[model samples]
Target: MSIARARLAVIIVSYCNADDVDRCLRSLARSDLDQFEVLICENGGEAAYTNLLARLVGPDRILKRISNDSDVLDLPQKRLASVASCRFQARANVVRIGLAIDNLGYGGGVNAWLEPLLSVPDWDAVLVLNPDTEVDPRALSELVAKSAAGYGMVGGNLVFDASPDKIINYGLHWSRMTGRVIAIGRNAPVGSTPSAENLAKIDAISGACVLATRACVEDVGLMAEDYFLYMEDLDWGLRRGKHRIGIADKAVVRHIGGTTIGSAVTIEKRSDLSIYLSARNSILYARRFAGWRWICHFGIGLLYAARYLIRGSSSAGKVALAGLLDGVNGKTGRPKVVPGAR
Candidate 1:
């Protein structure tokens, strides 16, 4: 098949959002292109949804990327660039499902499941979609077209899946003073740049939905699995900074974030694994790619975060401080593997 006709895979790394996964697959099934394949990596599920999905989509449309993910979390390290060994099927767009298996955290899980399809000879691009999302009909087309035009990776406006009016991510802006990261920009309208260049110039878009080219993988390498979950997208963006590629406004997606963490995040409290990971990962991100600027970036970030935690933020504070010390001390320790931690 021609490059244009080459299959574009969608990797859906699921955790516990069964209802959201159902909605996500339903949207994908209703897509204009029915030829694309779906790969469900059922990592750690009490009730396996892949079987139900296979029944709904029929076996042919669903490619079982991993059989009986009995101990999907057995070897976390194995999920990294190490899993890039499985080959892709011809003319097939494999959408990896990682729900019932071990939680590869964020980066590890996504990279692990996608290894199969990215191995394909004619595979052109892979779209990573969070499970709690309702994708726009033209999102796939926009991403593929732009990537083909020489933009290696692209991102788009993310409307909140719950409330479409308020955008979840409309690109990102780096605050010079507060050193805080902001999502969504004013004067948002969709189209290519004035020069008709393909890549989106936005500083940082949400990973809730991203369309990445094969060359981007070759150039930047895979997502850093060291971070169990948070900041993987920022790391990816930082890597692309080396090559000057970035988000594409043309690729539009709607996202429902924080599903992997827990619905408890909706509460006002700021102490938990969710908050802990965010605090820890921020420091981890600084150590890996930021060099000296990390000091300024994270210092301001700590102050901004302190405003949130105010009185009850001691748990996250301790985790963040510990992680920062570990990072600066040249340890950069891996997260202590909790037996059932995803």
Candidate 2:
């Protein structure tokens, strides 16, 4: 199909960030496309649902109250109960908001939406976008164009929102020996493109902005819920059987990276949740994919936890150690202990 006629479904997993969702939807409205829909899973529970409703509908009651179950939309009525459908910011895009029963992490939140829509033949491609991003007007078109050319999975150029002129990643580089995943072309000039060799080495597209064709989704299945937060994107790429991945350089997205988890380039600045999940998932990833290299993965995880201690982030250090232990025990799904859970 041609890019102009391609039906796209944009999926966003939101957590306590209705304002960010507002911005993201506004940017999406500028896309130069004829047909598209957005599916959002508000993973922050009841309070977040109210906030999202207030932000999207104001006081006019464009959509009915949540507890009034009779008013709910029936698009994905299986596991979820109060999924609501509405249009935001006067756009033609059909926005469906699914309320999560609990905090389902990133993967589960996305699955809440994808599981219901996979069989729906309306959408040609699915673009998983972070709620904190603002896309260039031409970005969606470029991605659909690449999808039309038969790329199973595609990623666009991501730049830091703080400094839009500097690139955050062209894609990602994974080290099997050390269990480290690094962004290719990180902090490089925005206009710079990676060499073909560098692009070929990309282990996976960063989860921040990944576009997967419907067939690819069918082949790989939904996002893995084992890791919950980090490393699942790489896991998805590793499991892409026979499907090819490509990059659309013209598709630019400005990302306000790590708003929910407090992730940062420097270890000292990362939140406890971010540190723990990163450390835990790295080991989990190695256990799944790495052969004897799992030992190296453990060593690297230990060093990372130690770095947090040495850098004086004692809380983060403790969390990282706990996560490593949980990972070693093959614990998966939502963590037992969470930030401020006490």
Best by TM-score: 2
Supply candidate 1's per-residue lDDT for 61.
36
Tens-place lDDT digits, model 1, residues 1-342: 111223676777766555666677767755655445444454444354444344334335322343322322212234422221111222234333334345566676677756644554666776777878876666677667767777766766677555655555555544444435566543334443322221243555467787777777777778777777667777776677444344455555667677666534432543355555665566566655566676776676567446545757554555555544544454432356321122
The alpha-carbon deviation from the true structure for residue 99 of candidate 2, after best TM-score superposition, in angstroms, is 0.4
Measured against the true structure, the TM-scores of the candidates, in listed sequence, are 0.72, 0.91
Local lDDT at 234 for model 1: 71
lDDT of each: 0.55, 0.80
Weakest lDDT window of 10 consecutive positions for candidate 1: 81-90
Misplaced by over 4 Å in model 1 are 1-6, 45-101, 173-179, 186-201, 241-251, 263-271, 309-334, 337-342
